[model samples]
Target chain A: MKKKNICITLMFSLVLGLCACSQESDSDRPERSETEVRKEEVFGEGEKIKLRGVYLNGDEVQNDIMDNYIKKNWTERFPDVEIEWEGTGDLTNLLKTYSATGDLPDIWYSDAASATAIINAGNQLNLADHITEDHFIDHYVNPEALYYSDGGIYAVSSGIDAFYTPAIYYNKKIFEQYELTEPETYDELIQVCQTLIDDGITPISIVGTTGWSVRNFLFFTILMNDDPKAAQALLSNEIDFSDERVVNALKKIEDMLNMGCFPEGVANIDFSTHMALYAEGKTAMIATMSWGYPELETAQDTGVFMWPSSNPQVKTGQVLQIWGSSLNGWAVNSRSENRDLAVQVAEYCTEQEAFRHAAQGSSLNFKTENPAEVTSELEKERMAIYNNAEQYIKTLHLNAMDSAVAAEFATYTNLLLAGDYTAEQFVKDFNPIWKENTWFEK
Target chain B: MNKFYTKKGKLLFALPGLLLFSVFVIYPMIPQILISFQSHNGAEALGYVGWNNYTNLFQSNVFGKVHRNTYFIVGCSLLIALPVSLLLALLLERASAGVRTVFKFGALFPSVLSVTVIGKMWAGIYDADWGMLNSILRGIGMEQLTRSWLTNADTVVPCIAAAFLWQYIGLNCILFYAGIKAIPEQYYEAAIIDGAGFWRASICITIPLLQDIIKYVVIISTLGSMGMYAHILVMTAGGPGDASRSVLYQMYYKAFSMSQFGEGCAIAVIFIIECIIVSIIINKCIAKEPIQY
Candidate 1:
């Protein structure tokens, strides 16, 4: 009887303790909407408001030069609005979890592919509501780039990103050792791969596990046939998946696979391993995006070129570009208690990043003061590719599609690299998947 | 004290555990069931879409493959893990103290290590260019046998199952060892007097008496294999076209990766049913009558 009384007393105390722990302290609660002011007016005066943020590249926030630069500069500009940032390598999965729980961070870094899902979940704030005058959207090199599908500016751009065209970054020393020049066309590239293979070297390595790299190779090949029309048809779902051009593109990739272009077990090779293969001189070439620039720069004697075209009519200068509408940037949580302050933090982060990128002479969709001069040889060459390009075509299939469609695209592409499907089977299998997921009207 | 012995007071003792179970498990399951029948985008239910998610799951090209892979993994755990663990336990029972200690530590080491570390270690072994498996094949003059293990559909599921089995085999063996230690020595001595060797003793005495322990381990192993996600995530990520994907991995991909929460929940419902059915079967078949000393 004494033990039973003790047990009841302990259980009640445990429940009470849980309840006590859950109650918010007086200090933890936000300052609330006491001060409704204009964009220029500072928020939370004499009080600190800490906003939690999760970014795609937030995992390395401490080591990130750009984030640190933004943090130091923003601290001086908005001293009261403190942001407690957390980084994640897998932002999409993180956001999905948060959105389900109705506990999204104050700010999150999102790209075009992921923005639709967040907005559909009603997690994104329409920046237009908060900033009526001097809106950041108006300053964009292309304002439409930041607009949500429903015609509201949901995200603010940090900088104008270059169209993500997967380029072949090669080991210059290896090329020189074999006396090989950069290949100019499909057949030439194949012949170059053959030479490398015969010399007992893998010609290329890709982030095959992710699926996007192989998809880039396929889409770029299709764009080679007729850049703009093919991109538009695919994006708008006007062209069927089993179209001759599409099937032909898949065959070209298959031919490369047959020609011993990629590393053994390419489908399991991740981004870091793929990069390491080139850096370590195990593979002669790597096909990846401009994001590979930093890693490639670190490697000695690395050179870059666009994936060579297959069609006779496709010119040397034609290249794929991510349009302004699909640029990645900062988004404020619509459901946040500190929505007003969150919007301010997001805007400050965006403008600050854009300014820094501008100062660095990187791509900018918006105008800024005193753009830095490009001095590095590699930077000069990259700029030359952009300048010399006949047209900047948007590859909508990869970038501008609904998030689900993009995910399926990656899955199917991974399957293709795995030898699970022939080119014909791939298209037949993917056609229904594409149709099922796509939101765009024909 | 006498008043506390009443039925109402006795039921109060179970209240806390019941409350916790209701709040954590039973409460969430109600909404999950509802969501499985609705069109959800992770955040909230959009509308009723009865049977759509289930129909889609059945219709999906990768669905059949994931199910088959899941069953294959469970089968491996049952067929390979059970017999091998029992054999090892029997061997350990007869071994000297030092050998027993070494064997025990060796068995539990993989179980205690992080799943990520084990998954990654296995991935490295199966890597195509520089992996230990391919290197061994090459060294042994069987270069033709050196194919990418994780990426190939034929070998991918089996490779993952091998890793999963390798992780839990030792722990299961330890459980069997404990059971063996509990069995009466007189039975074994009586068998020895009847000219029974180690094999016959094990077959007749150890196997029959260890039914209860075997049943428990079999159920746990089967259910654990069915619900596995992390190893697949770290190794192949349900890739090479979802050829190596399990039911849990597919649910994760559908819900988190693609934000098809409705479909994911439907998978969860089916998974729960599958687990319950499997547990019932294991209970019925393994130890119909509870064994007593």
Candidate 2:
């Protein structure tokens, strides 16, 4: 019996050993054909199609808009296709896992990196062919952002949330009490923080542990001096991350940390508390993008300022601006049996009718040239910021760099925030990650 | 012929489960090993690049720190949880029926609670300001002892281990309690009659008799420590500059976050080997031969 058990175990082990010599081929990555991508619009007008879509769950508004507002409109246009929406955690990891395992959900929402990885894997449908010049994609408020131009389009998004861009949402009442003017220079911003600090108040409520929150402060420095064009270049080694521009950005954030602008144990405070601290008037300011809206809304006297012109890319009036929004879009899985139908589904989901409804109850600025009609005064203020900017730069750096590098950026930045690394040491420590990166889309 | 037919009938009943075990469990092991050697980019398989993934895994800057963290958590389980669990079981074994019932309820409380709830609860407890832990420390005027428990690199892993131990110690206690109960009461009664004290009876008789369960618990604890990812993920998100990450968290980070699937699988393989080795060592140390009652 013992011998038999040993033999049984040995047999499984041997099988495992043999199977270890793998014959698995590259998944769906055949060599590209010489022809330009087939762009024929394959409209699904018949009963044989089941369109599968992966959507962000818990956004009941977006969900209602998709299920009722958009679905009814879409089916009226193309009657026979059955729409099945799959909801998942709003996680990029979920999409990435599906892509990795050759189980790309038929239609999935994707961020730039997720789409880029899929595109680079040669698994996404070429969207450019089917999307006409007259398509809703052309009307995106920021058409430049509708698709990443890698010689072809691969994804389509409903709209962009321009309001999510980083700004210091300050308590106007507190500023009035303290007689603090909105800062127009990095030094002045520090002075603002210092004046607030001297009055026995936390100068800023920033969530350090939640993510690389310092990146926004640093980006202000970068956008102030340089055009936001080198994100890809820096990753591809065309421009070094150790450049003076990059180092200066790092110093800008480091300076804030050194000045004790953020609260003690800032690294431990989560985003909710960070926002709450500001909402409750415990902090003088919050360095946040529009995602802090609900929190920003509660503080009835909150005023906003762009991170005081760090280096000013343009004259102060025409400073380059960004509205941080979801880098998500709809893409068709190339391996899907219903690839053609999936493309139609992507279009149906992101088209004008859908974009209009999805943008409803959302303060996000869309890429459409035909803007969603703004009813809220707050949205108009957001749009005025969007309108006044010379350049609407997207913060794609997080998605542009290797995920590992981005994570390390956050890690090292947290170290600076946590007092483990001084500004110079932060720069010194950053050089290694910059030197050894493997994931670059360029 | 009838016996053989009956045996075959038993095999037929187990076939579906056996097939599932083969396909879902045994089969995935081979590919998991195979994928470790391949250059999988999470985007697609980039073809085989034998040992390249392992080399990259070794090259990861955080690998050593993560390795140390994993082992430290395992050590915490061994040194702290095991002893506490055994102690609880011993106390429960000797307690009166009502006291035993109360102890059982207390012992199993954390076990039934979700790890997510436990992790989040402990996270709030360990919060630097207004947390139960810091508040108590402040209330006692040991304010210097209070710090951001989850944010400090020195304290993050230990704090997580404490929470993890909170869940696991109870579980192991229940396991040990059951094992102690299974020890025929006659042996304890006879030992007492011979003037053996409780400690002597426990040390000389009860403990030896519980070796079978001890072996099982040790193996489970070792494997549990090896694969512990969720609690740390929920509590820390592997932060304080990734200082609190275990090997499993790193594996997930590498594959999903960095798209380094092959390297992640390599970590998985190395983790599997570590688990197997630990299990073997524990089995050897705990019970070579079963002690018949």
Candidate 3:
């Protein structure tokens, strides 16, 4: 009975105490805290500012080049700043959780997706206010376009980017054996797929079960052959997703599905199986972003073709538009005391000498005209893809559209493959999600 | 005054714990509840919107699917996981002392493994195109039975629940085994002497004595299954579409991925109410039980 009484008393006290803590205080706080007084009185180097930052994890491409640079150079370069780095596989979620608690890091790098998220969370610091030409921000390729809006620059790009929807890597051995030339249009690609299917080999390997293991497959169909201006207009909200052009792009994807271009149960294949199918010479072609180069390189004599567009007028090598996003952009916390220093360090991290190491090591082309030297055949192939293209525009995801539209479209990847949802259904189901989000407004 | 000091001393002893609980658990709820009534993304508090977030959630396309999936997973835990665990516990309890000890130690092994590792192993099993599942199906000449388990919306939740079952079945078995051990052996002996078999004795004596243990298992399993996130996240990542998302996954999607913290907080408040109901049930059930013997 005594033990029960103690437990009841304890529970009641906890409840009461928690209730007391939940109440908002009506009393005003003093403008200056004791810590501020101490900070103001600090001597040399402003009390050694600790710069908290996040970077991509081990599994990502050549992040070691940047981390190595940081390890060897950054510590020596900035003695006054104590760098507390957290290398994470999940920077976006970490930042979201941190933003909820008002615990933003001083610096964080992302594919400039962080800028949208940070600005949405009201934590981004506009770099245009602090960074100057002498500071290396001007050195990045089209630095102005990196910002979502003309108002301010929230992210500084890494000056180099890997092209998405750049090419379809095919097995040169298989192409030679079949007497197949590199495909120049969707029809020709289908002819190749049909030939491979006739030969009892899967034409194009895809990873569907891994939730977007083949993410680039559909969007590139929409954007690849289209003029950069039209894509730009769409991204900048000059047109809606319901536009005929967008629907037509979606229809092209549905057409490809109808052609039986992919393997049986393509939606359920794992990433390893997808890779093995392509690498082990079971599949003739694999369409993917530049990162798949290392895996695709495993095949004997890999041949490359620019992702063929369905538009006949926009013939082979005529459509030059490459999918572009700010590959590695770092944003600083607006409220951090080390905001200025952090911004300075962000620019410094991406300067010519060090960033080239990252770009070359990661097998990416630099934004600078005199970019890193081509070191391998894959590097040479990647360059040809980039050089062949006339212009580059970001996918609809990274630009002015609402993010919900992107997520909605991402879910439809399965439905498109399964033939459950039509292109008309996509436009019908999606327009409301897109329209409800008043982009560039509250 | 001295009596007051004695009570105050006990309260003071609990102050550290109370402060930690208030800061970590209670304080977060204050903001969440306040924000649930407001139109705020994680960025800024946009003015109050009375029940609008809640309305928006129900009105979304995937809400019904998410709820169905969540309830389905919970049902799997209750209908499938509970019985399997109880059977294992009964067998372990009936085992010889040395064998029981060995089984008890072995039961902890799966629970001790990381959820992510376990989820990945099951994902491999469920994978199509030369996966263990399809291979086994083909080996036995049952190749027609295999399908793409994770990608198909119909089977994704079941596959994920299977992963959870693999993890929790052993854990709950150990828990039930401990609870069953506390049942006085003489009651079982007397029941057997009165012409009761193992099944009859268990149904009549052991189960009646296990009301408290059963209550604990049901609540934890139901709530834990309802909050399923990491396993699903690792296995399916909430889709070939959002087919596998539980309510908490939807909350995470809305709050973090979509940056709609207002809706996220509204979902959180809903969960808080759910937790309150769970607590109410627990409190109501805490009345002293009559001895089975």
The residue-level lDDT of candidate 1 at B229 comes to 94
Candidate 3 lDDT tens digits, B117-210: 8987888898766579888998999989897777777888999999898888989999999899888888877887899998998898878888
Which regions of candidate 1 fall more than 4 Å away from where they truly are?
A1-47, A58-67, A70-75, A129-132, A135-139, A216-218, A323-327, A355-361, A366-376, B1-10, B183-196
Model 2 regions lying over 4 Å from their true place: A1-48, A58-68, A71-79, A133-138, A215-238, A312-327, A352-377, A436-442, B1-18, B59-61
Instruction: Say which candidate scores most in TM-score.
Output: 1
List CA RMSD, all candidates: 4.9, 5.1, 4.9
TM-score of candidate 1's A chain against the true A chain:
0.85
Model 2 per-residue lDDT at B180 = 90
How much is A282 displaced in model 1, in angstroms? 1.1
Could you say which candidate leads in lDDT?
1
Q: What is the interface RMSD of each candidate, in Å?
A: 5.1, 4.7, 4.8
Candidate 3 error regions (>4 Å): A1-47, A58-62, A120-122, A133-135, A162-165, A207-217, A226-233, A268-277, A298-300, A320-328, A352-372, A440-442, B1-19, B96-106, B282-292
On the 0 to 100 scale, the lDDT of residue A197 in model 3 is 77
Q: Which rank order by lDDT, best down to worst?
A: 1, 2, 3
Reference contacts preserved by each model: 0.53, 0.44, 0.30
Candidate 2 lDDT tens digits, A1-442: 5455445655765576456544435565443221113122243333335567787664555566566656668768756656677777645777777776666778877665566667778777777766763364554565555555456666676555444566677888999999998887767888988998898989988887735566544444344534455543453467665677666666766667778898766776666678888988889888776546555766657777666655455443244435432446678777666666677677767764345544554533234344457655554565567567675555544434566666677777666666656667876777787666654445
- TM-score for all models, in order of appearance: 0.89, 0.86, 0.87
Candidate 1 yields a Cα-based lDDT of: 0.77
